[model samples]
Target: MKTFSAFAASKPIASLWDDAQAASMSEPELLLYRSNLLGSDLRITNFGGGNTSGKIDMPDPLTGQTAKVLWVKGSGGDLGSMKIDGFATLYMDKLQALKARYRGLAYEDEMVAMASHCTFNLNPRAASIDTALHAYIPKAHVDHMHPDAVIAIAASEHGEQLTRDIFQGELAWVPWQRPGFDLGVKLGDITRDHPNLKGLVLQNHGLFTWGNTSKECYENTVRVIAQANAWLAERSDVPAFGGAVRAPLDRQARLRVVERLVPSLRGKISGDGASGQRKQGHFDDRAEVLEFVCSQDLAPLAALGTSCPDHFLRTKIYPLVLAFDPERDNLDEVIDGLDGTLEQYREQYRAYYERCKRPNSPAMRDPNAVIYLIPGVGMLSFARDKTTARIASEFYINAINVMREAQRVDRYVGLPEQEAFDIEYWLLEEAKLQRMPKPKSLAGRIALVTGAAGGIGRATAERFLQEGACVLLADIDANALAQAEASLSERFGKDVVASAVTDVTNEVSVQASMAASLTHFGGLDLVVSNAGIASSAPVGDTSLELWNRNMDILATGYFLVARAAYRLLQEQGVGGSIVFVASKNGLVASAGAAAYCTAKAAEIHLARCLALEGAEHGIRVNVVNPDAVIRGSKIWDGKWKEERAATNKIATDDIEDFYRKRSMLKLSVLPEDIAEGVYFFASDLSAKSTGNILNVDAGNAGAFTR
Candidate 1:
């Protein structure tokens, strides 16, 4: 095996397991540090795909006695950013004792219950299924990961022999066994027989390395994976671009194909909208998808299963191959062909499940293809949101790379279909589905928030996301727009949020922004017209330029956006909602705010007109009149705050307090408060309500309207 110690760039390695270094750290801190470090390495694992554990002694909260505990990575925790809560602390002896009685137990829910029973009552987080595999090793620290290099060899036809050759006698090999009590028991037996074993290679699964310290185990894993990569490099002569193409494709042409085909494919795989009308799935156009589509071996090579069967839950067994030619076919023609193609895929998927499913297996999963492989064009990932689509894309790209390398070393092979079915329908995964937090009020819905770079608009976007709605932020400020998009995407999955530069007053820009939303999310369900400038001026002094600017944005902007969004909703036959961010000044005139007041007033009245018109089509239009909500608001950013304070003869710092003290409740009106009112109208909670005016001003009696 090649050693990683000399390679500075291979991965950060610890030369030795220094007890003194470890003794200085707490158990949770040590585990968290190691878990984060492991998860940070993309080659080792991605997102929430791996598990790590340590056997330690801690005072049992229930008994106040020092007890041996197994701290394992908990289910539903992201290893890259985990904390103490991310681990489930279980009594190790109790887990070990279950082995004798686990002889004939089922590998699904029953196994899960037995494992859960081993966890301390205080640790409510569910332990990982692989906890038993770690526990069986009887080591201080154990690490299990599905690194791409390791999976390449592990999933090949000559995987076992190759593993033997690479590790020689340093690692023990376990034949393919579905991960559960049986697999754990087998591991225990192997460890007992070979007490000198440093690591294990589970065929078609992953790698496990154990050591006396977390550092040792982590280093061992890194070193072994490095060795696997070196071994493959020495043997495999696979060209990066596999196969010579019949026709070399242009990259720009391929991207055009994606732009044309993805929207159509998204529409084809959706649930029925209002009264059986068609809705569309979200599409994420990925560049890596082009690798397989442009490959010479696209046909046979793409037919291979995932990097491993464990990836089935994400990427599925196989991708859906669609034929597309940007130069030859129209998008409509491609979509017309898709109906029959998707039908075939569904039928085949159903049959595959029937052929491979065990007794009492869960119902077959939805037959929609997650990855669409276009021969001439690139690939597009389809899912309910962008994050899932991206994840599917990541797994498929890894699968393609792994299988390509495996074919170079030997013939590429995959886990048996039945084994894949079990993992796909594993009760643990099902239980995870069952345990999923109830869908938010607007889950699966989409919303577009204007002026989203800051303030009330930004809050509304966040609120929409919190309620399970995907939001596309539109702002004129390119820098702030990009920043907001990045921040929101980081918090939510990139799939759930997008951003576009929009000058709502400009017809072309407004139209393009709306079009981008449909392309990003497949459809639009809600529109929040909140973009405006705080151009406060008395009616006599208000210049024509200021009047037109305020009118174009506050009133005309709402009209342009609402008009476009209305057309989309009407075409999809799925009625949607529209909320205008009117101000208290719109209802009650304020001196030196004539331009602002008139524009907001016009905006509110326009919403009322749209509400009357939209009511016939089941679309709801409402207005939110909010008082000053200055925190983090672009409207409140820059000299606006200082300018407003100067007009009021008050210190800038006390401006928010002034607004707070003016309300009947003596509390400031918040952006979230306005968002709640918007949510009520956007959601089914106000299905029968239209032309409604929600005063979110902490009891602004003067702003009340009949």
Candidate 2:
């Protein structure tokens, strides 16, 4: 992992612009290049927080005449990853003409709709609310960014005066206003009124700089933010967060406490599935988070909330501070009180909503807090998916910097509840939410698949991810495990895929795998116990050690995985699904395979028992049985194939075809076929069915239940 630094006071934000790299790009390409360079550094901007725009002369399709067009980052586009298509293009003359129809601040939202009428070249990318800010600036290029160093000054009590003192009229100041056409018009007035102004700081919001070219605009932004850092560094005599009231626990001790904390909190924060939506979690125990959480002013500063609109919108207005004592190691005490504490936070959120609701405001959103803080441990953010949770936590880190710096230089201030409510529940924002595509079936679900490096196991993991589940792939083979992880990560995303080399038969390893689930993706939701082996031997030839090996892996491994998953599911209170992969031999007699058949039968029975025990807690346990699944199966890749073929008087290479022809349906079963069965049980489609056996054996009446 890369070292974590929260923008050191002594270190300045440097320019990353390369003139040589910019020489060959067209105007629009340069805009993309400039945006990427600025967005690459977290110190300059948080994810999806800033935007860049350039005015270019492109030929109008109608008359083949050159027209001036405004190209700005589209709504919901991230500068770091966006291509040229991510920009919204509009005719500049049409944008300015809308001013003639503007009624005033009360009609700002209506003006947003008119921007679509001005779309150029049939561009479908929607213009952001900040479009007008870029449009009215009157410069060839405009860069609006949310730099932590600059926002620290903007969030302070004396922000306006500080801007004057630091920039000496080079950068101007605008008071806090919800982003809209009115703010944009006001910015235009400021620049038009003062030609000497280099940029302007939006009070309690962000910074704005403009230039005649993209490179010049990019340089001005970096230079201004760097100068702000230099100014703050010179005044950094005050200790951060009032000089840290408590020290962090040792690494192992912290892990011990967090292992207990996450599952309990995850269940409570998920609202016990009352809302029918469970959240995925992300944990950050890095040094940057520890500095603030262990400080004397953690509570008050966190309560005051974050300043930037981008920060507060991603995170909620404020964070929920979990109660834990580092000195006494009272994690048990903390766990015991999570229920009441969580309920209290919900009540607080609801009350805030009630107080701030407008008649036309969008109905209250999920009332749970997005951020959670533990004094001596770290922070955890929960959202609809893993990436959202991770990004939310990052935005909060930006908030921490804003608050810590603002406090040292002057008193920090967050937006009033009403102002924050207005922006969050704005009609424009509501429309964007409605436009979002529906989430996938397993969107926020997290799963762990054992033997994941093998064919069936890897197939099941991919199926889960395709439905939007974050999966942890566990296996005993290190090399196979690494290969499977890379392949799955390439297909899906690395952010949602995690892997660990785990031996399921061992209690310690099973326990550690559960810990990995918590740390990697908050907590577990589905557990697939599919690890297996094959052996063929007559009753007399089967040794005690051979029978024990079969029983140890097939029976005990399933038991261990189920036992650990049950604890995690119960702790989460969100309930879960556990699917066990046994074999068709468990039901049908296979000659010379007494030990394998007996262990397989034991696995089936154990699942039944677990199903009975888990039902009351909302945990569902099911089983899938496959017959002669040789293709792509790791079991078939070993001597087991030759042993089984010789025992049954069949050629080793033709065993799969022989089994397929012997079946009632004469159809061959593959790993993907088995994966389908597992997916059915793991998803909500089978929510009402439990303790059920699904046979994926291509119709074997010999194994049919009577």
> Taking the tens digit of each residue's C-alpha lDDT, what string does model 2 give over 1-706?
1212345533567778888988999999999999998888888889998999999999999879999999999999999989999999999999999989899998899988999999999999999999999999979999999998889999999999989999999999999999989899999999999999899999999999988899899999999998987777666667788877888877777777778888888887674444457778888877768888898889989999888999989998999998888988788898999878888988998898899999988988887888999888889899999999999999999998888788878889898889988888888988998998999989889999999999999999999999999999999999999999999999988889999899999999999889888888888899999998989899999999999999999999989989989988998888899999999998988999999999999988998999999999999999999999999999999989999899989899899899899888999999999999999999999999889889999998888966
| lDDT of every model, 2 decimals | 0.76, 0.90
Separate clash counts for every candidate: 2, 1
What TM-score, to 2 decimals, does candidate 1 have? 0.82
As a whole number from 0 to 100, the lDDT of residue 250 in candidate 1 is 68
Best by lDDT: 2
Minimum summed lDDT over a 10-residue window in model 1 is located at: 1-10
What TM-score, over all chains together, does every model reach? Answer: 0.82, 0.98
Give per-residue CA lDDT, model 1, range 524-550, as digits (tens).
788998888886656788899988888
